[model samples]
Target chain A: MDRTIRVLVGKPGLDGHDRGAKVIARSFRDAGMEVIYSGLHRTPEELARMAVEEDVDVVACSILSGAHNTLLPRVVECLKKEKGTEELDVLVLAGGIIPAEDVEFLKANGVDEVFGPGTNTQDIVEYTKTNLKR
Target chain B: MFSGYPGGMVLYLHNQIIQGLCERKRAGLARAVTLVENGSEHARHILEEAYRLRGHSKVIGITGSPGVGKSTLVDSLIGAIRERGDSVGVIAVDPSSPFTGGAILGDRVRVRSRTTDNEVFFRSLASRGYLGGLSRHTGDIITLFDAFGFDYVLVETVGTGQSEVDIMRYAHSVLVVMAPGLGDDIQAIKAGILEIGDVFCVNKADHPDADRAVAVLEAMLGLNRQWQWKPPVVKTVASQGKGVVELLGKIDEHLEFLKQNGLLEERVSRSYIAALEDNIRRDTVDRILTEARLDGTLDLVLTQLSQGKTYPAAVAKQLIGKYLCAEESDNQ
Candidate 1:
């Protein structure tokens, strides 16, 4: 079977501004991937549950509320618990107003890459295409 | 139990998945739905098992135009169903881009209120080139959900226009939601949609013209002439949860009407017919086309047609004769 790339673009904080997430979701869609946008104000648990239920290949979250250090890693931890098995590999990505200093901290946790505000959409697309774990 | 290398592995996985599904594990149900959505070879086995175990859940289809609050209404309905101590599964469909075959499934955003509730399972699907406002495998997925032992299954179609009435073939009750001030009063008079609605809801009832929209829909419903079960039009502001209970009550009444009148069986049989026809098309037309493309016959036909050498109907007849009839005769 020809598998289509499935990505979950989620906002895990109280950030009501979802413009960045919407843009990335659309970019993924235009690149021929199926994107599940988890609206807004999603907790880490909810996002993790959605990723597991949707069986997506990637979990690309956008957070602008400056809670990346606290929330992004929780998303990864919750996803691991939700899957309950390591057979399904998921690529975790973060994008938003994340700072350069915090990128290493996020990667140390579980995030594979971080795209800043001005990062090109195509670059993110390529990054996802190349870094997909499945 | 084909003990061959990969076939054995596949069989093992399938058996494990089916066991989990029978035991009401959400992970198993989720994986089974993915297999069906992806049209995997093992999907046939899963669906066969699902058919044997289904028929407990009520399948409801909610459809409307863009920005009609279908998703919000569905969220409210999920809460209502759960309050009554019943489990529900939701399938929300969005359209895919025709050029790129990509889709952004945002319905989950509006319907994520019940994400923490294990009894409420939600899945999003892209239409994936199916133009009738639904995914191709919607029926199969619904079967999987039903077999997982949910009390209710809600299938929300992509924002629809006139003539996306395929929902009627699969759903026992169809809820047609409309908002006020979208010039939908004229839309209520259209023939295709007016005939398929089992219950009509005028959402965004907080708007000033909400009552007027309700009036228009009722007037249209009155023109049906015969009245075995007249579809009731209820006003709701789905975002605020206003009038949602009444709407759900009306939907339940429709289901009750179907059961009492022996019409539920008819609807089930209609779904069967639709599923049969869909499989036939996939097995015949889609298979032939795929084989033709692989063997370069499609390219040859296109070249011939461009040169005015053959017509479309003649080409179709010839391909069917070559691929379908010849195989039957050879088997004989």
Candidate 2:
């Protein structure tokens, strides 16, 4: 098997609903991967540090408070600030109730994919694998 | 000189207890979790041992709007799991007092009567303005519980904001709670929430217009046809324990479906990577704030932006300095 992939999952800002994030985290655990969940209300700076310290391969963020347009990019910016874009080896993904148009915008800004409402667990798993494999 | 043999024996005994915890020994699990929460030296040793067994349990988070009765649903499921002879662990993420930073944890308080049950290991965490409806040490705590051998671990959060969504990133499955008469606007207002839920619960189904609300949600789901698992709609009167059994079944089915498709491994890998990055970012910030003392510069920048002397983006550009990616890419 390849090295155990690590991830830093966080809820940034004031949004408190974590049911979705927790479920995803558990799913990952059941799949036999290492996951470090930053318990709620994290700043982007804190999240970036978490990614680096944990040596995570990806940073999957779930934002439902509708701050993705602002917060998502800020998270990407924080990660990239240390070095060139190459320093950002971690795949930054977002989930939660994002509008269709906004998803495209976020992807343009740096989000790998924005899984919206009703995206199946299997699809997410497949997408994640395909992306990570690359 | 100290007796090395006795010390070694004591350490051996500690390891045995920790190993027992990882094997799901009830008393051992309790003791180990307490040790970690208390930040005891013994806890550190226990954690170090448990860390080797870390990536096993699936952490499912349940969150929704307040008064949607999320706790009651969790309670019902706990009871259901017990009926099936499975031990269940729960971490209730309660609201923190914005003023005092203490947590109310009303959910745990309501379930106090069940705390004495040998099969149940429950903890209440204070959000403490942690923003994501979880404790800063939540990851460690979850690992502690998992190592302790709880078959199913559930986290219930105060259903609002990015904090609740953050919990999903940590969990294997997410259940979004909603109720009728909350109005169409709430549904629309929280459209982002609708997108994240793997399972949607229209709680308080006994209330008026419940079916209509379900209809509306069904329509919404229909519009979005690109999901991995068709987000199922489960209606319940959580306060009364109605539909609890069906809901539990659905949860199990979802779990099985994920396992069957080999999606479980992929999801876990993504979550692991995400978690690693989050940990790195958090540590880096702590180091900067504590060691570099960048507060002064941050304050200066904020002041400058507020005074209209510079745009926020421009300030960010200056604060980060000239090693912009385009400029630095050539050197690397």
Candidate 3:
């Protein structure tokens, strides 16, 4: 059986701007991956809990509220702290109005990749396919 | 601990998962559900254990058309159930793309109010080409939840049309949610849906036509129906969590009706029958197709089909005879 890569597309924090998240979710679906979308205003704890419960291979955080500096790393930290998720090999990705300089910091803080504005949806899909830890 | 293990290592992980389940760990239940959803080789062992530990939970099926607030209603219902001191497990199903076998499961978005609560566990599923607005392994996952010791297991189906009455086979009480102004009056007259609903909910009651929708559903339900526990229609603004308590009350009343009349056992038996049929199809039809694909028999059949040399019915008969009857004869 072909393993279907499951992704948790989360918009953590008070950002109601989920257009980018929805677009990426559609792209992932079109690429034959299952996307579990966590709707707007989700806390990092909720995202991590959902990722663990859903057993997803990727945790894609879409932050348009410019809180990525604080929120994105907390998502990774919460996932690590979530019960039974310590062993889960999740590829964490961050996207949305992030500055280029902060991309390195995000990656160093457990985000595997950071997609800035104008990043193609297909690139995210291919990146997910290539970078999946499983 | 569940995936990518080899040989005996897989068995060890299965045992570990089972132990975790026995200890009532949330992670164990979550991983077990994933294993069942994936149809892993270890699923049978887990399901066997789950079946042995079943019968503690009430399975409620919530289904309706798209945008009828099924997920929102489920989220509210979860609150109601929790307020009554019952732990609930929610399995929300969404349709997968037929072209790509992928899906966007957005139900969890609406049903995320209880994320911090340990007693509330929500999992989203893709229909995965299974028609009838549900995943193929939905029943098995419900079993896992029941075994995990939840007091209630709520199943939210993919937005369904008229023919998706499959939810009735698994649920003790089927809640058919409808929003106002969806032309649901005419929908109420649809045969398959009207007959299967144990309780009907007209959601988005703040809409001007909410009363009309409820009246239409009641009037349609009253048409020539016998007095054996008539299905009640409740109105609710699910987004605001209004009228949810009444809706849950009506559902509980229906459950009481099922219990008093001994119909709950019938529903249980129906679910078992459905499970048996599903497993038989997996063992027979799925196994046959997989083997045929592996041995190039499917390629030959497709060639014959495209050339108009053999019809589908004839090919099906030949394959069944060769694969099934031949095995029977050999056994004899």
Q: Pick the candidate with the highest lDDT.
A: 1
Docking class of 1: high
Question: Which candidate model has the greater TM-score, 1 or 3?
Answer: 1
Q: Which stretches of model 3 miss by more than 4 angstroms? A: A84-88, B1-7, B184-186, B294-296, B303-310, B328-332
* Tens-digit lDDT string for candidate 3 (A19-125): 88998899999999899999999999999889878889999999988889999989888988885455548999988999888988887888999888888888888
Find the 10 residues in a row with the least total lDDT in model 3 chain A: A80-89
lDDT (10s digit) by residue, model 2, range A6-30: 4556677779998888777666555
Cα deviation of B212 in candidate 2 (Å)? 1.3
* lDDT (Cα, tens digit) per residue for candidate 3, span B1-332: 33444458677868777766777777788788888888887877778778888998989999988899999999899999999999998999999999998899998888868897888888889999999888998989988989888898999999988889889888999999988888856667868866788889999999899899989988898895576988899999888989999999999899999999898999999999998888788778986798789999999999999999989999998888878765554431
Quote the positional error of residue A76 for candidate 1 in Å: 1.1
Question: Model 2's lDDT to the true fold?
Answer: 0.68
lDDT of 1 by residue, B1-332 (tens): 22332567788878877876898877788888888888898887778789999999999999988899999999999998998999999999999999999999988888868797989899999999988878888989989999999999999999988889889989999999988877765676767866788999999999999999889888888888888999999999888899988988999999999999999999999999988888788778976898789999999999999999989999999899878875654331
> Which residues of candidate 2, in runs, are more than 4 Å off?
A1-134, B1-20, B23-48, B161-163, B185-190, B294-332
Candidate with more favorable, higher TM-score: 2 or 3: 3
Alpha-carbon DockQ of candidate 1: 0.80
- TM-score for chain A as predicted in candidate 2: 0.92
For each candidate, the DockQ is 0.80, 0.01, 0.74
Candidate 3 CA-lDDT value: 0.87
Runs in model 1 deviating more than 4 A are A86-88, B1-7, B184-186, B329-332
Q: Cα deviation in Å at residue B40, candidate 2?
A: 7.7
Candidate with best DockQ? 1
